[model samples]
Target: MSETLTLPSHLRAVRAAIADALGIDETEAVPEATLLGDLGAESIDLLDILFRIERATQVKITVADMADLLQGGIPDEEFGDENEVVNDTGLTHLEKVLPQFDRSQLTEPLTADGVLGLFTVRNLTDLLTERAAAAGADAA
Candidate 1:
């Protein structure tokens, strides 16, 4: 089997953390799901989720960003409701913007150690955001 490096990049690691925390399958972990009410995730679980997401995507998602995402942030009218776009922060849907990802590559596991290695709960989002901005610049 191909290693994780060959798979398409995704937020799978992030979802996996949420799933693990909620004791559910990855499929049930949707973007719109509330971490507390829907996934039964406690505040600490949310921090873990952010950490995993950063590890999985190599993107830093800030506390403000987390708040926005958790709250169903303001959407950009350009992408329509089908795509979750953050208008306030100028963030577009990754899937919409970067369509080249191979879904298979998204299967890699985001282990606890790996997630922790990437970020701490408090800094995960902000670090992820900074990384993403830098990456977007390189891609452009």
Candidate 2:
């Protein structure tokens, strides 16, 4: 994670917030880095990061919002099978939205929790920027 100033302002703010939440160097919050897999961000850290993001961008995105966006309107029962494993339909949706995730790495069925590995910093930045723009539009 080399120090660089080439990132966009929103992305810079995201990286900074993530790094600050996780107690890591800002450079460690690379765009492609997975929040859970690469940076070891836990659920609590996510809350802290979101708080920081809201403070920085004035756009709030709750964890439930993230879950809904990830699900893409799929029902909770359909999103996960009876065994709580992600079904083929769920996998398809995940692959479509979370292209950063390597599905081949799964040696067994992917649980809902495993999907967190797909959430990269870039995804957060993109989602946040979209939400911010929508907020601005509403304000207008």
**Candidate with best lDDT:** 2
The C-alpha RMSD in Å for every predicted model, in order, reads 12.6, 2.1
| Backbone clashes, candidate 2 | 0
Cα error, residue 96 of model 2, in Å, equals 1.6
Model 2 lDDT-worst window of ten? 1-10
Off by over 4 Å in 2: 1-4
**Clashes within 3 Å, all models in order:** 11, 0
TM-score of each: 0.42, 0.91
Question: Per-residue lDDT of 73-126 in model 1, one digit per residue for the tens?
Answer: 434353223344223222233223223322245445322222222222223323
C-alpha lDDT (0 to 100) for residue 90 of candidate 2: 88
Give candidate 1's whole-model lDDT: 0.48
Q: What C-alpha lDDT values do all the predictions have?
A: 0.48, 0.86
Q: Which candidate is the best by TM-score?
A: 2
